[model samples]
Target chain A: MKKLINKPDDVIREQLEGMQAAHADLLKVNYEPFYITRAGGPVKGKVALVSGGGSGHEPMHGGFVGHGMLHAACPGEVFTSPTPDQMHEAAKAADGGAGVLNIVKNYTGDVMNFEMAAELAMADGIKVQNIVIDDDIAVKDSLYTAGRRGVGSTVLIEKICGAASEKGYDLEKLSALCRTLNQNGRSMGMALTSCITPGNGEPSFEIGDDEMEIGIGIHGEPGIKRDKIKSVDEITEMMTVSIIEDKPYTRKLKEWDFGKNEWVERELTDEPLKKGDKVIAFVNSMGGTPVSELYGVYRKMAQITDKFGLKIVRNLIGPYITSLEMQGCSITLMKVDDEMIKLWDAPVYTPGLKWGK
Target chain B: MLKKDHVLSWINRCYEVLEENRQYLTKLDTAIGDADHGNNMHRGFKKVHIQFETLQDKDIGAILKSVAMTLISSVGGASGPLYGTFFLQMGTKAGSKEELSPKEVAQIWRAGLEGVKMRGKAEPGDKTMVDVLTPVVESLERDVEAGKSLVEAIDQAVEAAEKGVQDTIPLIARKGRASYLGERSKGHQDPGATSSKLILQALRDSLS
Candidate 1:
């Protein structure tokens, strides 16, 4: 309940205003139906990338809105999905005459809102396609549940796909590349503490001092199971093993069929990881977990990947995607091809993630 | 007969009722799902309440359509689209109508219920708003078929919704965030169902 904020109602708006002030050179913020887009406006003749979700996960969709990353991000209330109007407006703002690609995470609210937005945008004569990411391995049944929550892999998709767009990839090609990345990535997380949303003014879930929840999503929702607190190595091993050894996930996902101009359900499957596959490993914090401790988790992750003969050709460690002050970390392993590696190494500049020019 | 004023009264009653039960619904959600159902519902209806200024002279269909757009734009969770679609379908069914007979009201409820089902894809026992809505719609339809008055039919529908809320306490969740908990989701009342009951109660109170 105790946090630094003027009021619960103004939290999102004030934060966005502060972000606009701090990063004016990089992005522009639109209020009313809130969304953030690149400062100089949409890149001409390039496929624009747009993504969004609930607000608590900071430095994600918003912070990634800059050069070589997301072109626009629609932020909703904390832990709530953004409405269709925001996305529709953002797509209109970011479309560069090539088309627009919506990088949606696979949550019920997020998917439904984005689907509605896609419909709205298409009706406006804008070419739009949606690629949903469901890379978390924690949820066991897609048929019975909302399916695995999209976690760290979203960061990777935005970065790599952003680079692809910069390289003149068209809307259809960008959508296909996004699907490939989603199929190859898996993530798992563990939380030592719960997060308090500003509006609720309470911890999302209560946890015992001596316990931790495993298989957690970015939101402070309770994970698959709770267990006694273990050492960093043990926790890392559990999460890494789950990601590396996860079975191929098959689920029915809705995609817009341009031919019919409607949403259609298609069954898609993510292939599992195996030995000799090269990967870009990402270790992320859930807001409150410090980078120094993430190194401890990463140290163990590096050793485990070596033992499994999975080559970690690239690695990103930090709070690239995070929940609001929740003490936890998640690890994502995305199998990479030569093209993906080239994209990963491409020059990029954003507030949350910046390197290589 | 359900008149335009009655529909407006129902919406205003929903805003007040949801605000009053906000914490209680959030508490219910804390047990089995993320603890935001109350806040989400209140937020959506609060926006709907503001639109009442512009809605006073509109037809029932136009009023409900405005409410749907407000909720869909302002409310940013699973509840937003589910409830938004409910109102949208109701508005579509009641198009250009300033008043409705008992059967028309029943048909509107049926359309709203089916819209919720299609949007959330939850069955009757999935411990969602659909659980409460299904029985409410069925009760209204049955009562209307039996030549009941508007007040009488709505009263029976509210009772059915109340029972539906209680019925969810023992069932396992198979949809939404609560389903993530598996069997742990049992024993707690579904927050969505509870709020749905309030929606029906608001209608009954409006008619009375």
Candidate 2:
């Protein structure tokens, strides 16, 4: 608690004020303590997008606000969900005349709060839709237990869907993209150390100098198991295998029969795509993972992707998403088409995320 | 005779135990798991201590509910939600009661045990808080059925809890971070079980 702070009560407010001062050109501070929207609002006729969650995972919902990403971001206290009031303000602020879309992670409190905000917005005749991100494969009995925890891949989905919204794809297309990403993308993480909650002034979990946590969530939620610390390569392989096993790239798309009509399967006519299958690769660093280690992980991921005959059409590497200082990273790969490749290269600028122009 | 003040004193005593053992708990976690049990418990109990000030006008259930919420929000680690859920469940069962009789205390303990099971999804052999708590609740209920006084029943319950905590040292962990160790978890005492023992011990000491 010896850190610099005027008061614990004003921590979120002070941080928001500092963010406004630092990036006034890129963002506008809303009256609500944790809400920030783009200065000019959503580009006219574009789908307004809003997202937010607990505060400790910085640069997530907030930093990703800008022209190409989110129109508004709402933040909660520490790991707590932002109240409905904050979300309502954010939804109102980001309405670009088309409508508003909420990108919410699948945490119980976050879902409940965002749902409340959507309800409130609807009361005022605002058309709002929501897509929940739940990409973590680590949590088992997910359909049974509070559903899969939304982990690192959320950042990737935000960027991809944001790009789609910017392209005037309408609510249906944005929702479809969101669902496709959630269906295709999977993430698993491991932690070398526990995060220290700022107010608590100590690590959230105790990791022996030698031990590491495998399959950890962002909240330092206990992972699938704790085992002896493994080398970087082993840990990376473990995570990758889990993800791949869950969502293997079935290059072949099967045909389905409707009640009245049947569609034929699309055959991969090419020579097994030596290195030309477009793929967007994301190497997401959990909060405590450093840039150096994240790069190291990418190096390994590149090798693995090469082995599978998939070319890395685009790569995003950094702490795009985090779990409050938890030491780990998750890798996300989306097999892309020519259209997606073009969209991925489209220009975009946001405080927390940025891509090709 | 156990008075209402004694129950309140037990809460304070449990806070003291968490404060005193914070570092030790963290150190133990450091060896085999993420090292935050001690710090998490410390942060949670510290919040609980502050909550007690505002709970003077509330009944036992309200007091426990406050403790549970504070722990859930303030403590981020597994222990926070686990312990918080335990107390929250206990409070839910305790309802608006001013004070708990021995049988009621035993039932409250059972509720807490069930809550932990629901939250952590741990069983008796999981080498978790349940290993210690389940035994104490059973012993307390048995003691009460045997016509023991409230204080005596609690004392016997504390003894059973201590033994249950000790049993965790030689057993392999089947749940939580310690389970990641598999056979390696056998030598170290389960931090959760240890804390549960301390909770019972605090209650006993407060009664004296």
Native contacts conserved, per model:
0.60, 0.02
Q: Give the DockQ (C-alpha) for candidate 2.
A: 0.06
Candidate 2 docks at the CAPRI level of: incorrect
lDDT of 1 by residue, B51-156 (tens): 7799998999999989999989988878888889999999999999999999999999999999998888899988899999999999999999999999999988
- Model 1: per-residue lDDT, tens digit, A27-63? 9999978999999998999999999999988899899
Q: Which segments of candidate 2 are over 4 A away from where they belong?
A: A1-20, A24-62, A65-151, A161-180, A186-278, A284-304, A321-330, A336-349, A355-357, B170-186
For this target, which candidate reaches the highest TM-score against the unseen true structure?
Answer: 1
**lDDT tens string, model 2, A254-326?**
2222242332233321121234556677887777688899888888777777776777888888887787667
List runs of model 1 lying over 4 Å from the truth: none
Candidate 2 residue A135 Cα shift, in angstroms, is: 6.1
Q: Check candidate 1 and list the clashing pairs.
A: none
